[model samples]
Target chain A: MNEQEHIDKLMLELRRGTITIGVLSQLSSPQYGYSLVTLLDEKGIHVEPGTLYPLLRRLEKQGLLDSSWDTNEARPRKYYVLSETGKSVYEQLCVEWQSIVSSLNDLILNKGDDVNGDG
Target chain B: MEMVNRYVYAVTQRLPQSQREDIAIELRGLIEDMLEERVGDGGNNTDKMVEEVLMELGSPRTMAHKYRGSKSYLIGPELYESFILVLKIVLISVGITLVGAFAIKTVINPVEILDHFIEFIVSTVTAIPQALGWVTLGFALGEYYGGFKAGDLKLDKNWMPSMLPPIPHPKKTIKRSEPIIAIVFYVILMGMFGFSSNYFGIFRFSDGEFVGVIPFLNEAKFPEYMPFLLLLLALFIVKECLKLISGKWTMKLVVCTTVVNLVALMVVYFMITSQSFWNPHFMEGLMNAGIVEQGTEGYEIMETIWKNVTGATVIIFIVALLWDIVDGMIKVRKK
Candidate 1:
């Protein structure tokens, strides 16, 4: 493929890996599907409403989030927030993410081809 | 508003029954939010804005795929390779069988050679796609219903480390050519006997030009066993297919092939040993051709074949079947 196509595919993979963590990090407070999409966009994550809605449902299914409908308005909005299990999971995930970022930064900055001997 | 409902309905219809209503409500609410954002202070949602918004969200099928997670295939990737493998075998088997069956019909009563040839081509062409459809349907059912047997094709929910299959010995692996050759062989036998023993005999030549022949089967009696022979062969072909799919001596495979082949062998034994199963006119035809006479060694050979045909057939069947059965049992039980 040309450079644009290769970059597009690689960027999709990169964004997919981080999108879950971005969504999880925001759900400490209750937010509905569309609100979550807008909230992430302001932070530059730019998740589609279609993607976020299904992901919210899946996270609820996995017991990583809890959901309830607030039908008080003219239209009902399903709200999602981090569950008890989700809180602990996200905290541990943050620790792993921090370690991975540093390791990757070190490799990128140093441009190391060998771990045994540095260039 | 109607367009929004149609889009919501399209997405939710693909989801499961229980999740449909909840997903529909949630999807409708998301659309309204997006439309409101698009219209802004004017607070009017137009058809153009709705169309643009839905188009941006993309196809309803893609929306459903996101909701359902990994269920977008009729035969998923896990089952695809096996499905194609079974399809090839089934198509080849159908082609071989149609060719054999048509050859018998054409031989028994010679119509115009072209008519039989046309019929063979037409039937084989029709049969292959029908076979393809059936094989696809079978694999699709297995895929959707958690396999023909639960976890038999892949992982089970109740899987344990101990449940993992043992690595088969290298020698125990079934060669692809083995089942392929056996399927052709079975197709031939089904063709040979189903129409009653004809076409197999010493051919007579007059002045080096081909003449009329003697057949080894009683034309009238063998057709009586036709249905049973066809059923036996169908079972044998299925067993061979299982072998082709498994590619090794899996317990499920070995047990199936051994039992099916043994039953087929029994039907074969009965058909071979039945009274007058051999053509009574075999010797008479030989004598009539003047190729053999009462005092000739050729006559003695023909008589031996005619009288002791059952014994010879029984020996051949037992030897062939015993090798297949014993080979399977031993391989499957290997540590």
Candidate 2:
């Protein structure tokens, strides 16, 4: 593939991995799909409604999210919040993410030093 | 708006019947929310806003696919590799067999060489779509009833590295296509036997028509043995299908294979030894046609040769069946 396409694919995978953690972190409070999209976007993590809605449904299906429809407004909204199981899973995921980030940071920082040392 | 309704309809139409109402309601709510948000931001031109919102949401088909959580693939990615492998094996083997059979026919009767090539081409072309249709149908059925849901594509919370299957030794691991190909081969053979027994007989082109010269097997006797033959074929097909689905050699499969083969061998033995199995008038017809001179040493030699060939064929089939049973036992033991 071309360089631009290669980078685009890599970025897509990177975004996909982070999007789940981002969604779970925010779903501690109840948020409808559109509101969740807006919240993530405001925080500089732009997720499309298309992606967010399905993910919410999937999370709910997996018992990671609890969802209920509120018909009190002019338009009904299905709001999702983190389940009891989800809270534990999200905390574990955060710990794992932190370890990965630290490991990667160390590896990346050492790259130039290793090359320079060899020279 | 009409545009909103149209888009919702488009999305819901693609979803399963059970899911349609709930998804449609959710989609309508989402769209309305999007439009409301846009209008609140002082967006003029309601039509333009609707179009923009829809565009941002992406194609209705893709949105529907996301909501449904899976694309409606007749044979999905989980089964795709096996399907393609099975298709290749079946098509290639069928093509080879057809071509090889025709090539032999051409060699025996050089005058009909052109006809043989034409026959080969026609059969191969027709067989491809037939094979593809059957294989696709098999996989589709497997997908439908086998609980191959969209959720299967995801890594669930319970997933662990330990869940991965141990890498099998090459000899122990059964290729998924092996049983599928065998099933297709047997199905085609069954179809031929059921519908075109005349094709198995000797033919001569006369008066611009291919006429049966000397029938090898008595057509009338076929009805008597057909039910037994069909039962054996069904047993074989079921065994192959079990193999395909399991994708491995197991004790149960080995036992089933052995039983089926044994039953099939008995049926074959009975048919071959039966009084009405061969056409009684075949030799008389050949002699009358002057193909074989009557009361000659050559006739006696031809009869002896034919008897020996039939005996050898029966022996070969028995040996092959025995070999398969032994091989299955060995594989099961290895496992």
Candidate 3:
């Protein structure tokens, strides 16, 4: 694979587990699969339907999401929501994310300081 | 080929009534979009475009998996392993039980016993692999694609209006022959088992050697357990008759019954044959000299017959059930 494709693959791996977590966080309101993909993309978290749909199903199967078909429109759209379990997991995930960010910040700054001292 | 499309429909035909149309519409849209994209700029013929897209998409299996998500690897590295595991456990247990029941008959004519079980095992083993492959494939696809979001798996308790037309002029009649059919099967099994010992002597024995006889009664010398056989056969036939009449019993029930019948028949055969000293007790009795054992030859023969018959029966029943379900829906549409 080219460097960009390799990077994309790596990025996909990183986002794979978290995309469902992110989607669940936003699914207090009902959202269909395709529309949900667009919403995640607009929010700077790009998730393709191939990845997103499966994750949504996994999360739903795990009792983290709820879905229903709304045929009110010309086309029926399956809408998903955060279940009670999903809400709890999403909250915990947010806390873990914050801690990871803070730790990374400390590590990066320490690396910068070490370089300066060496120079 | 158009025929291939019909085959695809036949498989997808079992999709739940409510979801079928939406799934079909989505599938059609995807196929159309792919075709349109292929035809764009490059003036590829429609046929070529379809062939190319379908080829890229791969088999119905691959397409089905794609929609369902990651099914080939979902079960395990080898998809057949879990089902093989299931078949191994089930068939082995049944085989052991069958052997124990038929031990007496097998001892008399060990060859026959070996032949019978070998045939059964070969057929059972072959069948289970295919069944497991398809069933696991479907389940994996459903699990992957249906994406059972929380609460969706629950039986929809909420009364939704039927999309299809309501039953017009409900028929309040039952098939009268259903009861008669059950009675006839019960009588036949009773009559067969009732004189089994005498019957084996006269028919199953040949040239002072035990030949091929029924499976479940392999161990037992018949006339001994005629009453038990009668009772069991009655229950079996009654259960089937009830299900046939009710129509409430789904295809799954029929499949279960068929499996049970095969297992029961194997047990019955072993019980019947074991009662004799010589494997071909009747023939040996006629000679009134030595124990002429037919050995495992009979078993091999039995096994072949069982495997072929069971395998064919399982496939036919599954296909018929699926076709009938789809046909039933189509009929409803017409009405």
Per-prediction interface RMSD?
A: 0.5, 1.2, 4.4
Native-interface RMSD of candidate 3: 4.4
Give candidate 3 regions above 4 Å deviation: A1-12, A28-30, A57-85, A103-119, B1-18, B22-335
lDDT (C-alpha) at residue A84 in model 2: 100
DockQ of each: 0.75, 0.65, 0.08
Model 2 docking tier (incorrect/acceptable/medium/high): medium
TM-scores of the models, in the order given: 0.77, 0.76, 0.36
Clashing pairs in 2: none
Specify the highest-TM-score model's number: 1
lDDT string, candidate 3, B48-138, tens digits: 6677756654556544454455444554433344345434433443444344435545555766877766755675576546645765775
For model 2, the local distance difference test gives 0.80
What TM-score does each prediction get for chain A alone? 0.93, 0.93, 0.83
lDDT of 2 by residue, A1-119 (tens): 99999999999989987999999999988998888888999999998888888888888989999989899988788889999999999999999999999999988988876765644
In model 1, pairs of residues that clash are none
lDDT of each: 0.82, 0.80, 0.56
Q: Give the poorly placed runs of model 1, Cα more than 4 Å off.
A: A112-119, B41-43, B97-113, B147-174, B188-227, B238-262, B276-304, B323-335
Model 1 / residue A51 / CA error / Å = 1.1
